[model samples]
Target: MQSFRTEIENPVVERDIIELEKKISLFRTGQIDEEKFRSLRLARGIYGQRQPGVQMIRIKLPYGKVTSEQLHRICKVSDEYSTGRLHITTRQDIQIHYVSLDRTPALWAELDKDDVTIREACGNTVRNITASETAGVDPREPFDVTPYADAAFRYMLRNPVGQEMGRKFKISFSSSEEDTALSYLHDLGFIAQIREENGTKVRGFKVLLGGGLGSQPRHADVVYEFLPTDQLIPFIEAVVRVFDRHGERAKRMKARMKFLISGIGLEAFMQLVEEEKTALPFKTYPIDHETYEKAQTLPNPPSVEVAEPTDESYLKWRKTNVFPQKQPGFYTLGIRVPLGDFRTDVARKLADLVKTYANNEIRFTLRQNIIIRDVKESLIAFFYQELKKLNMAAFGYNTTGDITACPGTDTCNLGIASSTGAAVVLEELIANEYPQYLYNSDLTIKISGCMNACGQHNMASIGFQGMSIKAGKLVLPALQVLLGGATLGGGQGIFADKVIKIPSKRGPEALRALLDDYEEHAQAEEAFHEYYQRLGQMYFYELLKPLSSTDNLAPYDFVDWGNEEEYVKAIGVGECAGVVIDLVATLLLEAEEKLSLAQESLAEKKWSDGIYHTYAAMVNAAKAILTSESINTNSYASIISSFDEHLVSSGKVSLGSTLSDIVYQIKTNEPTEAFAQNYLEDARRVFSGINAFREKEVNA
Candidate 1:
């Protein structure tokens, strides 16, 4: 286990891995609290699966971009440390399941050699930064969002402000006004734009804030019509700072930024962001777009004689899966990864093919598919022939027939039913019976194992959420049918409305009913959502309500899709957003750890980072004392007030001024070296006072 430690080259990453190894040792020995250990492991992208003693590791790929070498490295790690299968997520991350918990540090070390990472992939941190797959290659894009997304990912990867937050935060970038990245559903969404002022073309973004989807979906509000490129990072930093300070902590479901904004109002939230600007290190952080402006190294021509495909299937694949790039004579080939699961053997061959005939780069799509860029126009047939052999050349790249689904009962602990299983049956039903829908781009179908919406089912034209229903004394798997959701470009969208619930066995029947009704009554050239809106949600409910009956059920109705055995409801506790129980001792230990990090940042001359670390240390110490008092607190803002009221007013722990006065200095003062040093010293004194009081009280 220790052998791979020495192989890591980056000192920061090596230290992170070593700390993980140490924490794992502590956890094994029962020295660390299970809840705290879960939080730690999750930040490293090691997620607990439904099955015990195994983990599902999420490999974070910023903006879904992966080079051939990186793909090769991921394949190697999956084969060595996990099952050979890779599951692509809607966020464009690749997950490998059934991995041993002890081998994760070594696995991470191996991936680091190829500049790949898993950190912050599945936790209450800044999750993977995603963008449109066609960012650089899209013909309508004003300028590529790749560099900006990369900058945000890099700036927030190990940033202290987001290391531990109320809940996970998501960010996305759209290539154009098309909003292909689904920016309306993200916490922070940016749509690329360019404006000409005084004969100078200034690149900027139309920024949206506080958007999210789950049980309650909220469309993002426009925060900025035009925010210059230079201010992107600073604005993000300010917002995260505000969220960390005032966002909910105790209520797991309400901890999202969307809820915070909804509760406090956007005007109040922006005021907090404005107050944080004084402490920001950069007022205008410039991104290096020139670095990404360089041309990609194109592949050489194919050497072997490959026959051109003239079959009907080939023509359909060409029409559906091939896209013309902005670069002349170059095309992008789309591979529809069903349920986003592909084996390492297929991955290795795809990697080789990209290196041989494309730009040696691939971007996993938000729809959980793969896009190969810079393929020469003449080589499209060759690529298709090669992909067909791998069983990855299916048509309907992003059409109605191409369904998006999460790994439900297959791997997710929180799964209520088999989403991937049901998805397979539905896709087969569409291909066999409703083949015309394959060419329809106006409709989408997405399925989630549960209402958590990991499959993004709530945002599709047609959606299904896995659920359970009772018939007399027996229980059966069911799906909550949703309809009328669609994304309108330029930061506008609508969440699907739940229409009805039907047995899992009758999902195909429900889909058929919806499609048939739309075809029968819809006006010419009307979209699915428009047709549904024209009729109304209750109208579709009545049409499919017949399939909801359980009285005529057969024996197969008792079983979930893709399963041979009878259904047994085994929903496990999810670790994605664990509710942390703070023990006083544990909180103090964390406070000390933060102090150490603050010292390290100060030594490295990172004033802003050091200041944030110092601020967190003070808050941790206060929360520890409050926990000892049985005074439960939620937000960090509450912790400060509670500490001041309970301890300071009672004269139990004395400081020169109010707790708020000292802590709010982070917002009032500039993050200069002198202020950072002073803040660290103040944190040390505050922690010492609290520790002394706690020890004395315990002794007494």
Candidate 2:
């Protein structure tokens, strides 16, 4: 760790690594509580894998854009510190597996050298902000959203408001009304929009709020039809503040922003957002697009004529994997990476390939694939030949053959079965038997190792979730077949209905049955989504119900896919979100930490951050006192109200009127310099009064 210390040029990031090193030492020595230490490391993007002792390090790539140099840097880090294997997630982030937990800091230090980050990649923070992979190249998009997406990522990277929350908050930016980023399924989604105002073209977004996908997926509601791009950042900040204050803290399953919106309808949540506007630091946060929208240098292809490949496979590959960009004379080539896994050797070569044949950049798509943009037309054949050498010239880019899946039981602790393994089988089945389905974009297939839907099985036209069934006394691995899910576009989508469960080995047979029925009876004009709705869920269930029969289970039915051993179900604890610690001492220590942070923010004159820190400090202080009396508080709002009823109303602690008045003053006043200082002073006073009351109670 000390060896890499001097290598990291950024002082703040270097300090963060040093702090993590110290905390790891303390944790190993049992000086720090396990749960507390977990929270600290999670916020830093280090996660524990199912395999004991090692970790899965999620490398943060903003909007999935990677410069050639950055890609090579990631490959180097993976080769040295991890298994040399890189996996792309559904959220457009890359993950490396089986890394030693102790070496994470060194790995992070190496990544920092290239300006890539893993901070806030996991554990209850604003996750990697995603956008349409085709943002800059798509023909139908109004304007590229690269700048706005970059702005959101930069502003919220380590912002105090989103540092901790009841659950994760996901944000996305779509390039156009096509909503290729799947804006309808994010906590906050921004679809790029342009309107002519006073004869000037104005850029804005159709904002969608509170959408999420897990076991129960919810479509996001439109927060604004056309919000000027300037208001995007401020609006998101205020919404996060509200979520941090009132979102559920105890029940892990119901802690997402979608639940909060559902519990208190969208109108009520919007009202709360309105109430938080004055406290926001900026009224309109403008993002500069000069750099983000700049065009790349056009490549000069070889002047000599080159023979084009005559292979039939190359034609199929060309048709599905290449897109003519809106920019004349340039094309974007999509690489269908099977199962989102590729060795570092391929990655290094691919990195060099892009720099040589196209622009020095690439974008990782939401479907877990890579897209190389701005390629010269003359270089298409050269790229095809080069990709053929690397065996990365697969035809289907985002079609049925290009199946999307999470790394289910392979590494994820929450995985009940092998999602990736099943994905491999399904992809082979499509390429070998159902070859006609290769270019069929309407027929989507996605699988999850479990119901958490990391694979986004809930939103696929044909989805499968990992499950287990009891057959006599033995437990057999199963897949819950689902149907009818589709993204309706323009901020609309439908979640699949669970059709039936079949033995894991019988999954292939079930797919065959579903397809056979669809091919024979479906109208030629009907897409998969239309056919599914026309046929209904129960109809498909009955069509495939024969595969669900357990009476004929074979010996292979007990084993999960890609596993040789007999499957014994073992699901480990999920650390997707941190559990709120209930200890009074811990709460007090957290309060003091917040106070220290408050001082730092005050010194920086970040009034909004400082004020929020002070507010959190006072609430934590009140909770500490309440805990001393054996009273427990759930949410931040309840903590304030209970303090008033138990201490302020009883005259044990005085703030002139009520604790609510003291704690809730942030809403009444803007986050000005004067108000920030005054609020900090009031927090100091309230903190002191709470300590005094606690001492008195202890003495009695």
Superposed Cα deviation of residue 104, candidate 1 (Å): 0.7
Q: Write the per-residue lDDT of candidate 1 for residues 1-700, one digit (tens) a residue.
A: 5789889999999999999999999999998888889999999999999999999999999999999999999999999998789999999999999999899999999999999998999888999999999999999999999999999999999999998898999999999999999889999999999999999999999999999998888899999999999999999999998888888989988999999999999999999999899999999999989967875455675765678888999999999999998889989988999999899999999999988888888999988999999988888888988999999989989988889999998889999999999999999999999999999888999999998899999999999999999999889999999999999899999899999999999999888888888888989999888888889988888899899998899889989999998888888988887658778888899999999999999999999999999999999999989989999789999999999999998999987777888889998899999999999988888998899899998999
In order of listing, the candidates' clash counts read 0, 0
For model 2, the stretches where C-alpha displacement exceeds 4 angstroms are: 301-305, 626-632, 651-657, 693-700
Angstrom error at residue 350, model 2: 1.0
Judged by lDDT, which candidate is best? 1
In candidate 2, the residue pairs with backbone N, CA or C atoms under 3 Å apart (3 or more residues apart, or in different chains) clash, namely none
Which 10-residue window in model 2 sums to the lowest lDDT?
Answer: 295-304
Query: Model 1 RMSD to the real structure?
Result: 1.1
